[model samples]
Target: MTSFFATRLAVFSTLLLGGLSTAWLQAGENPDPLGEKTGGSTTVYASGKNAFSFPLASLEDEERTRFVIGNSFFKRNWVEAPASTTARDGLGPHFIARACASCHSLDGRGAPPDWSRTLGPEPDATVALLLRLSVPGKPAAHEGVVPEPNYGDQLNNAAIAGVKPEGRVEITSQSIHGRFADGTPYTLQQPHYRIVDLGYGPMAPDVMISPRIAPQLAGVGLLEAITEADIEGNARAQAAAAGPVKGQVNHVWDAFAKAERVGRFGWKANVASLAHQTAGAFNGDMGITSSLFPQEGCTAVQIDCLAAPSGCPAKGKTDKAGKAPEIDDDTFGQVVFYQAALAPVARRQAKDPQVLRGQALFAQAQCIACHRPSYVTGEGPFPSLTSSKLSRQRIWPYTDLLLHDMGPALADGRPDFQANGQQWKTPPLWGVGLIESVNGHQRLLHDGRANGVLEAILWHGGEAKPAQQKVLKMSLAERQALIKFVESL
Candidate 1:
């Protein structure tokens, strides 16, 4: 190690050896010793590449079979319709990827295309990073957005053999530079996107596009298990406190419940349930239909897409209704179960003094306001599947599960349900540190613009501008400690 690294290691050792007083450590409000179990009993101990792939630790032996089956479907590739493999056929007339794992490799986060390499005429095809497109209009109460007259809600960059893709998504970026209070310079990549090679025609002049990177899937069920009352209470408390971090519940239409419910998933909290989220992904990402989303994601203008054969069962294999979704309820349920039951990997070195000090710095900076620490989950969305494992167990996910204005710097200028252009749902911080280990990349934010945690923090604005300012003013050691503390989560 270099002298600088050796010096850091020595100081870290000293801190671990009680260089900080016991009283001070206790005063900093260290989390529960078992807080390392990020998903409570559902937490997994894996820290390697396969960390995000494990099922809940508390799942019964029989449930493991379901998890295995779900993993298969999640990783399985779908072919175009009229193929021999009818079970997994009917991929897309126009779609982004053939399988869910294409973007969320290993069930972990997806990285954006390399901006430098993407500037060429033949840019890389974006599998994980998709563009959500819409036109300006008064959205119906149940509808969050008016789909662009041409390409529906999202821009698909790939298609089946006989059909042309909607278009290719191109990206380029400029470097943003800034410095800390100590004059330590930093650079951030600010991305610019374009939709080219339109398979159909030009989109509306006022079309809006939002770039979304597929987030990790671990502990999603646990997040769903957090009660509406608890989540709303967070919003109420923030309002009462009169803090700039006031969060609001996003009530969105639920396909499962057939009613408006509190949004719990998505970057904008537009999705209300995991079933809806899962089914929507099946339709939008791979063009595979489920009972929840029976219609294919095709526009009337796209004649090829409209005429494409579905992967539904043969005529003789029809149900009592004389029709069936491409993916039956059983298969869809298995995938949802797999997503809900994937355990958050256990934290590393939570008790280290440097980490604890950093934890204090994180709180002092008021990051805990939005990144709320703990919640005892309730019975999740699927009572039968989640069972008692996720019920009444305290988990430290570090998110408020509410929408806050993230400022223009991070805005996509697209409204999603109740979330305005600047508003974004607070993402959970559990397993954040392990993104590099699990996915071999540290891309963060909805569009994968930030390279790591610090960059993600620096990009913070709107309600979080104060918190960002606090971090900018931190001393080098203090910043390191704060980062170490967040990574330990």
Candidate 2:
């Protein structure tokens, strides 16, 4: 027992040196109570690059093999329907990226059009960025938000060959500048956009638009494993705390359950479970029908889109009925398994004095009120949710998985389920530090408008306005510390 404890302590000590935070130096003794395993025993030690794309360390041999299989489908591109390749066909009559990997771009966060800041023509060329549209009423009866009459819920900027792309996304922008308490200045770019070249005619005049960039997928399964009860408990604690931020549950459709459940995924917490979220992405982002979403994303006005060659229809109809839904349960299950199995990446430099100060400053600014530091996920029912190592382990994901008003600066002015226009979900912070290495950019926030972590923090408002103000008043050194601390997580 003595030898075992010493060995454990030594392993934990090693983790503090490389797994806790950015700039964490090797401590004289073990410092992390939970040790270096941020995602329990499933934590993967990777940084500088290729950090967001590894399987959990504790995943067993069969599970790791399964992860690789799922990854293939996640990265595979789907072609148009009525093609030689039936398994991968049924790409959008109207959709965005050809494959899941395109938007996610290596299982990581996406940015607004890369060409938006370039000197090239048609600067509004969108890649991973997606625009969600809605009106004043609920079209699905149960769904609170209504789809734009012509373009449906999402504006598919691209279509399969021989189909008129719904319309291209265009953005007009302006910049606002501000000075830190110490007189350091920064500029925030605000964007205004319009839909040009409407293939399905004009959208509803009362259309409400929301732009979302695909977020990183690592540790998502761990987040899902956090029980609903614990999530609400966090909300209760925040509501009773000495803070203005009050995060509420966003109950959204659970296609798998065929019922409404507390949403914990998406920018608005509009997706209930990984299954529902993945199925929705298959249909909404790629126009591929699954058992959960049998319909194409096309609206009635998109006559060409509806009439386009499709192996899978909203209803089960086609010469090959087996392929009508495009993605079968087995295939989608593998994809979800891969996403759920992607290991949480290690932290860097947690023991550094500067990062420690920044960590304290983050809590002092009340950012921790909404972005809760840690969670010990519940046990059992692990498939598509958690692994044994990821279960019941204290992990530092830095999210409450609840909806909070983010203020007008970040508002999409669109309601998703119970998420008000000004509300957004607390995004997880794991793998954030390595975004630059994996995706080659550091853009943050729902629309990828913030140039870096500082800008993202500065843009916080509404329930987070107080924290934003606190950060605004912080000295330059404190601000740097806070950002470093967050990046380390």
The whole-model lDDT of each prediction reads 0.82, 0.77
Q: What is candidate 1's lDDT per residue for 270-314, written digit by digit as tens?
A: 998998998899899889877788778889899988888888563
lDDT of 1: 0.82
What is the overall TM-score of model 1 with all chains considered together?
0.91
* Predicted model with the maximum TM-score: 1
On a 0 to 100 scale, what is the lDDT of residue 92 in model 1?
80
Mark the 10 consecutive residues where model 2 has the least summed lDDT: 117-126
Q: All candidates' TM-scores?
A: 0.91, 0.89
Candidate 2 lDDT tens digits, 1-489: 445434443543333222333323343332354234678777888875568789988777888889999999999888887888777889888777778888887788888864343211111222478889999875575575888888888888777767777777777678889998889898998877777778877778889989888999988888888888978887887788776888998887788888877899999998878888899899998888887887788787777787887663333333355435788778888998888888888778766667666666776677777777666677733554444666766677888899999888888889988888999999988778889888888989998888888999889988998898889899887888788878888
